[model samples]
Target: MDVLPDRAARAEFPVGERQLIMKKLIINHDRLKEARDAFARFHFPVVGGVADSGSISLVMGDSRTGKTFGAKSYLGGFPQRPGERGMIYPALLVEMPASGGYRAILENLADAMSIAHTLRMNNSVLTNNILRGLEFHEVELLIFDEVQDVCDIKNPRLASDFKRLMRKILNLEKASIVCIGLPETYGLLSSDKQLVGRGGLQYAFLHPYSWDSDEERKSFRLLCDQFDEGMPFLNKSSLGATATAERLHWVSQGIIGLLKNFLFIAGSLAINDGSIHVDTTHLAQAYDWIKPPQTSFNPFRDDWSKKPDTVVTTAPLTTHDPFAKRKRSAHAQ
Candidate 1:
């Protein structure tokens, strides 16, 4: 049963990820393998790192830098060892709400898992059951993206409980956990020594590829080429050898996650207007579309001067108006 695209997508899932597919955007097979190998080694990022071991991790980056994308890729490839078959290993991925905590985290998982039983209010028992279900599913790994929520743990003890849940993974019949979020994730780890010390599970961090690097640009171009077939209309090819990956580098602030939304918006526009391909104009519009609203401006301030000059104040006078000539004709006659 494949999930097909439709308008109800908004009603069904969160934004950005409703129709997201890593294969649709990046050739991360090699990068993906590096993470898996690192996990096997117990290296800082791979094994001994906070990212790999902390049951809850905070993976933060500019909007689109592949933080979520990388987690999805890992989830897709989790527990790849042989004899891993007949394993009903369940892999559950859920977003941490903008403001989140251990309770929200548990509830989201419980709901996503669609467990038959009720999770007792703030009960750790159900949380453990959630962990046990993964074991029953033979799921070897657990990945929770949008981890910035770990910071939402206000119950001073909530953080400890979150860590405790992670430690339980070690107690599982067969399971591994990966928590990803923004830089705040590291802060969460620094506060808890015991949580950071567990077999020193590795923290795998995926950095944004430098679109300016000749090498990096080459890869991005290759991705452009790979996607050309699907994006038959987005003639990213025209930009070709000269395509300024740097522009994307600057705009996306070098986050692989950001590129997906930026490009998708551009591509969707081209599709709608029946454009032959994606061009600079399409890119510009996409830039606006993908930009999250600024946090600094206060609508209540009533300070017009504080608003960005770029904010539109009036529709530009248009030549295409059907009534423009009629007014002139009346005057001329």
Candidate 2:
């Protein structure tokens, strides 16, 4: 088996078509900082665990809440101090396939490590090699994203295999596992007895705030101020203004993803219109594009803005499948 590939040959591969590269910016805001702090607290304790037993943690949240980003950020900052074992990676991050068996999982791990592909190897052999590879790399923390794929009830075998594989991987000294997924991941992971050890903790990534809570409202106002201060608008954003903040809260439902998207869309619109201010009109235009369900409490509407106090409070819309049939119908896709 050609486990050691020619690095020069791989480098000869040509680059693909040019992509419409949008600037990828990381906003170091309060919410993301909180998540990172929580991860740090979770990580240190697991490092002291026994060699034979590893800690399993669930980082569950609604989609687009920056769970993956936070996890990656934490792992990216892992200690790289060189020692007798060479460059030590205190953590490593990998993503799960949408659907596949144990073979697919092995392949993904091999791909991550840039190991030469070897399909002829048996499953047990491949698994052993991967374990050795992780040990060789000295990865103490193993992070998996989109882990809800293993929760498919229709294919119990895949889920069962996932648990078995995780148990094996965690056997490494001071090795800890982190899984990031939507809220359903908590329920799915809890249902599996093999996975439900009471030793681990479950953390929600996106914590939505209530409009009525004074502390929450203050925190949101501060967040709005930070975002507004960072934008390049000449007329200075009033997103932190009490009325504007109220309207913004209604529009975003306090979801960080929606709130950030609204700001970006509105800011872009303002830039395109040769204006420096993001007012109600720009926000309204952005809301039209966001096309949140046409509820009675549409804050973007002119009438609603005039009587912002009348905006009815509703539960945060986290469960709505953005890719569902209704979404396609609404978007004319």
Candidate 3:
């Protein structure tokens, strides 16, 4: 990622500077760091020409909570290197197709590994090619983003087929698998005893920060401070101030992606007006542009703190372990 120009150089910059700055910024917030650590733990190093059995790890989170971002960031750490045969990829990250069929899944994997294949190729051949490509590229970790598409299938037959394909991949022990999706993706492991048994069914979660918890509030404030420092402006924006942080949390719902976007617009507005720093006035205008017209609440308003409905809190989405009872039963046996 490109670093922004020095603060002194950024002063009195043109209106388009916001685009240049925001495009290059990539913040590794706390939750994203946790997700990366989980990926690292799942990857096992080979020894004495032998590797441990491939395991499956699930990374579940709400939309825009940085699940995909974190996965890609982990992939970025393992750049493709020149191998005796060709380029070796230590890790691969591919998205689950909306259709979520076995063939689509294989095609997506092939595309990511840069393996050539025709649309007419049979499933068996394609599967073999993908597995071979995984070995050929020496991939140690395979990440599947939007995995809920396959896990949430309504048709039992489709679901069974997908699970069967996954079991085969795990059996090969070519690479550890990481599935990234909504919390509902837990169903994939709960429904399949074989998968759970094979991988121990490890789980990781990414969640938006909340203002209620003191720890979470402090973390959110620190994130705001980091973003404030990252923004290329002549003067500090004081984004981490108590009042400002609360307003930012309100508008972005503590999601980093949303926060970055909201701030980008606000920063652009400030730049356009030749302001030295982003202010509430610019934030107010940016919110109007990004939010729906029917939204009555504006956190940037003077009386925002006094408004009755100024803060709206919603519980984070969570998954209950469907296998808890089964595990207890097995232990009793």
Best by lDDT: 3
Q: Write the per-residue lDDT of candidate 1 for residues 1-333, one digit (tens) a residue.
A: 133343333223332342253226454433444444533443134444432332333344433455565556555644333344333534556665554566776776666555445544545677777776665555545666655455445545666766776677655535556666665576676566665565443465655555545676676655444444334342333432433344554444444444555567766665556565666677667666544344233222324344343322111111123122111010010
lDDT of each: 0.50, 0.66, 0.76
Candidate 1 wrongly placed segments (more than 4 Å): 1-62, 77-87, 94-101, 111-114, 119-122, 152-155, 171-174, 234-236, 284-333
Q: Predictions ranked by TM-score, top down?
A: 3, 2, 1
Error of 1 at 321 (Å): 40
Q: Which stretches of candidate 2 lie over 4 Å from their true place?
A: 1-23, 46-53, 79-87, 201-205, 292-298, 305-320, 324-333
Q: Write candidate 2's Cα lDDT for 1-333 as tens digits.
A: 012223233222222100000013356766688768766656665456522237777887766677877887786677556758655666767888875677888888766655555878988888888788777767777778888876567778888888888878866645678778788788777776655563454555556545767788888887787667555554567898877887787666666776877788887776667665678888888876765354443456666434333332232333334543222111010
Name the better of 2 and 3 by lDDT.
3
Q: Tell me the TM-score of model 1.
A: 0.61
User: What is the descending lDDT order?
Assistant: 3, 2, 1
- How many residue-pair clashes does candidate 3 contain? 0
True-structure RMSD, every candidate? 13.3, 9.8, 7.6
Clashes of each: 37, 0, 0
Which is the winner by TM-score between candidate 1 and candidate 2?
Answer: 2
| Preferred candidate (lDDT higher): 1 or 2 | 2
TM-score of each: 0.61, 0.78, 0.86
